[model samples]
Target: MPIEWIDCKPISLVWFSWREPLLYVLFTPWLLSLFAGLLITALTVVLSIRLSWLNRSLIVISAVLSVNIIYSPLATQWLSVWLSSQLPQTFERAEDAPRPVAVLLGRGAKIGRATSRKAAQLLNDHKVEAVYVSGDRLSTAQRVVKLGAPAERVAGDSCARTTWQNATRTNAWLQRNHPEAPVLLITDPWQLPRAAHAFAGQGLKVMPMAISPQLNSRTRNRLALRETAGTLLYRLQGRM
Candidate 1:
């Protein structure tokens, strides 16, 4: 269901959203915290010797407690909202002066296809000269052509999985091909803040055409905790 259609209550929806990947992404920190907590409990027992078995027994208890404890500030609040808030956004086609190059960042083919359709709406009103689709649509090139953009106008970047790279790559392509054209930056709103930063930093005069939304304080606050935990973990592992 569209997020705008219903105000989401976490309690009613979390169980229903309990697919493995979502669980893994949201509950990843709980697992790590639990593991660390158990190791600490084990170390304490090792030092005493008298309570070695007791410490081992306490591991499961500590792990469960750790999972539930970390669950409150992080998982339900920030991570869920961070991920789910990036659903598809519908934008009113830019109608004033022409945005000759519409830069659509791709999370997938249908995503690009949907965004491309929006670009076509802009094109119909002569608002943009062409669509710049950034990401791997794979076989969906045919779909892009089907949406009314000429094949040469659809620029694809298969390597970008992050917004920073997307902005950099799209900017490079624009400089080479359509340097003077004003751009329509199309993407989900939750990620837009960082994206706009990166794109504008690249000196693209961006007119944003948002696809989804950034959740409210109720949601962003909840989701932020999860992302904070995740960011910490990523730092520790040198993955960030």
Candidate 2:
């Protein structure tokens, strides 16, 4: 089952299906901010016109907010790049160290194609001995297999719905299976810090390998904003 909070259905369904533009409006940060800014600006204009005593300050505030909303995508991109630079792209395990497992966190019910490709590449490059995906195990395993990975080399944990669950459950699996192996935690750059924290908290040694998406400005901004919010939420819950 999907984690209630991480799953988009509750919010996306209210507007439209996951594939619809309305879902973007509801979940995408830049678009949602733009929509809100426009609405506020329109309201300010109507009030200013209707009341002679309406303060010019309100108009100025609306304009500034609108500009910020429009520019959010660029801001998010900058943040992601900065965060990516602060983390390592590759993990080097000592020759004597046990072979590490590549743990790829799923985006939702599906392990996205980009992540699947990255996992396959890691296996091919000999960066990891095996790949363990968290989220929808069956689907994630299927995706890896479709990407040409041997079925035996890929493992899955379907019960993990949140980052904490991902870490704890995977850690348990590792302990039972490959106790001394370090983990190559995989996810987007923006999500790496929290994921690393969660895994480390579970007493697992982690080496983060981020998959930075090549998204357009608007999409990047949306992802950044979503990641920002997720980070904050995790912090509040004392998970990161």
Local accuracy by lDDT, each model:
0.57, 0.68
For candidate 1, the lDDT comes to 0.57
- Scanning candidate 2 in windows of ten residues, the lowest lDDT window is 3-12
lDDT score, candidate 2, position 68: 66
- Candidate 2 TM-score to native: 0.69
Model 2 per-residue lDDT tens digits across residues 108-197: 432266777888887878777778887644666667667767777788766666677788878877887788889988887777877887
Which candidate ranks first by TM-score, i.e. highest? Answer: 2
Q: Which whole-number lDDT from 0 to 100 does residue 110 have in model 2?
A: 27
Task: Return the TM-score for candidate 1, rounded to 2 decimals.
Answer: 0.54
Report the lDDT of model 1 for residue 121.
Answer: 68
Clashes of 1: 9
**Among all windows of ten consecutive residues in candidate 1, which has the lowest summed lDDT?**
1-10
User: Which residue pairs collide in model 1, if any?
Assistant: 77-222, 77-223, 78-222, 78-223, 78-224, 79-223, 89-211, 89-212, 100-129
